[model samples]
Target chain A: MNAAVLLINVMALAGILVAFMDDREKAILSIKIAFKGFMQILPVTLIILIVIALFLGFVSPENLSGFIGQQSGLGGILLIGVAGAIMHIPAILSFPLAASLLEKGISYTAVAALITTLTMIGTVTLPLEIRQLGKKFALLRNGISFVIAIVIALIVGVAMEATLWQ
Target chain B: MAISSQISNQQNLKDWISFGIVLLIAFVFLKIYPSKTGSVIEYFWQYTMEMVLILPAVMLIMGLFSVYVSNNMIEKYLGKYAGIKGMFLSFFLGSLPTGPLYVAFPIASHLLEKGARVSNVIIFLSAWACLKIPQELMEFQFLGWKFMFLRLFFTVILVIIMAKIIEYFFEITDDRL
Candidate 1:
């Protein structure tokens, strides 16, 4: 296993031990909650896995680069930003997918846009946000997030390129 | 509670249906490209194993946070503070990795209703959406420290500014009303 995975596992184990030492009942409850969460995420995780696999398997790097590579410019970045805003995959899963996209020649700007919008804006959960927060608050938050996501993407794109040249 | 459970059940069913559709698409594509089937499955298995290895740990951490850090605790602490202290507290509370962004909306609304500063509420919600600890760790692992740190830095500064702008707009609009 990778160091990240191992580190996480060790932390989890230590946490569980502490929790159990503190309160057996709460520890058991935590485990139950974890199991439920695992089950809840499993379906979506599997779907994303298959989609990523197919994407890597079927799409040629040249085609992917043509669509969203460094040369694709701002238009491609905006397209991906919109996609990220609408999609509902788990943020953790998105990182590996982003890494794969990077490997396939997608621009850093597009990938940053994707991650930012994916995490910040939730088109699917808009109804819930509106219901809980006021219409103005929800709309402003989402709208401002979309704009900032693009800005951040551009900054990251420029900064990473500068570092590479250095 | 009954209504919410029903809605959740419906959501679960929708997810399953979509999963099935995606699986069918994968099967069809593999069938069409017989030679590529091996590579596809190989990639799928690789990711599945990677996710499986760490997800339990992540979920366990989340579960502990959910259990130990009650919503009442957040409300109590966040509603009492103001100024820079409040902003930092909001950021800290929201970055706890307890649940998804949707789950945080009600809490944020509650905080606002209880007279928490508008800027803090915005900071809290934004932090919850993008700055959870576990989520950042995963990003660091997959995307490298530089990419992760740079994004985090930019997001923190930009989100605070955005929050202040929104709060200022709200203050003016409330006065007009």
Candidate 2:
């Protein structure tokens, strides 16, 4: 495994050990919770894995890059942002998908927009949010987030471009 | 609790159905293009292994945080603080690895009902949605540190601004009403 993965595993193990020392019952409960979470996410995880495989296998880099590459410009980024807002998936899984998109020549701007909107603006959860936080607040938060997601994407794109040139 | 469990059960069923459909599609695709099967499996296995390696650890961290960092503690902390300190506190509390964004809705609403500032509550919700610690780790693993850090930096700055703007809108609307 990579250092990042190793570090994460070590940190988790250390945390669990510390928890066990502090309160054995709570530590056990934490593990139970962790296991339940793992199970809960497993099906979604598998589906994403297969989808990624299909994407890589079937979708040509040329076609993908044509749609979301550097030349695709603001329109592509906006399209990606909207898609991200509408699509519902675990944030963790989005990273791998983003990486895949990047690998296939999708612009950093588009990927950033996708990740930002996917994480921030949840169209699927909008109704629930409105019910809890009121219609005005929910709509405003989501609307503002969508706009800012595109802004962040543009800035990220420029930053990455500068780094590459240097 | 019963209603929530039922809702979760329905969600679980939906996930399973989606999973089965995707599996069938994958199988059909492989059958249609036997030559591509090898590459498809290779990609699937690579990503699956990468995900499986880190997910358990990530979930463990989330679980520990959920159990130890009680919601009442968060309310106590964020409800009392105000101004810049409150914003930072909200970011910190929201960043703590916890359940999904939906789970944070109630806590955020409670904070508001308890008289937390609109900007702070918005920051809390936004941070919970995007700036989550575990989610950041996953981003770091899949995307490089530069990508993760840059996005995090921009997100923090912009989310704060957005929150303030949202708060301003609320104030004006409240005044008009």
Candidate 3:
């Protein structure tokens, strides 16, 4: 709901600010062009969301959840690393997913890493991103992001764990 | 700039084909995924208002950007030579965009067309989607400050390095492609 509202307010401001500039006709035309682009993608966005949600509802995050939430041991770090590689669910959905994970005894560090990776990495979106942007770009970006997200999770987990837990 | 009518036509054809492919895939998924089989009606209603509002706004916003934000302005400022100033600009501009992922993807193509380097585009898209400040704060409210800030700080640095790595690869690939 907050996201929806922020999206609205920002859109209005963007519109009004642009509308004030020289060339009203051009402004209006550009807006229409943008609209066409938006319409073109609406169906796909909704479809992707539904497909992802279905993956959520049926597939179950439990087994992997257990693996990724380990606080110590190389096994935990490795599980967290793999989890970081494929976290493509959108940001909005991660909340409910995180809440459920906490209830299920998942560690905050793992959940945090998963949530960050959910937005950070894009294995699911890789093929599409590749098509649009090119394969080398997609592979490089996602691969690097996957590595970085894992490192960040480890560092953050250690820092917070030491300060808060000890 | 006399953009070839043929080029636009070719792009249109490509867009249609991609859309058709995705649409077909969507239908197939809907068939196999029975859970959401009949839920379109509810979804249509729930998303209708938000869709209507967002569609126009996204259009206008993007239109304004493409039209008003001059290509040279982007290049002269954020192009390879602009250094830290360009990087900061890319970060700020990238963080401002909104929409579901679908809206973001093609606009990314448009940005690339408009003189944005692969480095800037990938970084912008990644940061726009993941490293957004507002989204971070919201998560902080839900999760905790530590989780949010740590992710942001790391993501920003990670994005810079990844962007550089991608830039290096593309420099090599362009020679071949």
Instruction: State the C-alpha lDDT per candidate.
Output: 0.86, 0.88, 0.60
- Write the residue-wise lDDT of candidate 2 on B1-177 in tens digits: 343467567877899999999999899988999999988888888988899899999999989988899888999999999999999999999998576677788888898888889899989988998998888889989988888888999999999999899889978878311
Task: Give TM per candidate.
Answer: 0.95, 0.97, 0.57
Record all residue pairs in model 2 with backbone atoms less than 3 Å apart, i.e. clashing.
Answer: none
Docking class of 2: medium
lDDT of 2 by residue, A1-166 (tens): 8977988899899999999999999999999988888887788888888999998888888887778898887888999999999998878889999988887889888999999999998898888888888888889899999999999999988898885644
Question: For every candidate, how close is chain A to the native chain A in TM-score?
Answer: 0.93, 0.96, 0.53
Q: Highest lDDT: which candidate?
A: 2
- What digit string (tens of lDDT, one per residue) describes model 3 on residues A35-118? 765555444445444444434444454665555555445567656556655654346446445544554556666766677677
Candidate with the greatest TM-score versus the true structure: 2
| Clash pairs (backbone) in predicted model 1 | none
Task: Provide DockQ values for all models, in the order shown.
Answer: 0.71, 0.78, 0.29
For residue A143, model 2's alpha carbon misses the true position, in angstroms, by 0.5
lDDT of 3 by residue, B136-168 (tens): 544654455666677678778878887888888
Ranking of models by DockQ:
2, 1, 3
Q: For all candidates, what are the clash counts?
A: 0, 0, 1
- The CA root-mean-square deviation of candidate 3, after full C-alpha superposition on the true structure, stands at 7.8
Candidate 1 structure quality by residue, lDDT tens digits, A56-155: 8888888877789978878889999999999987777789889778878888899999999999998988987888887889998999999999998888
Candidate 3: deviation at residue A124, Å?
A: 3.0
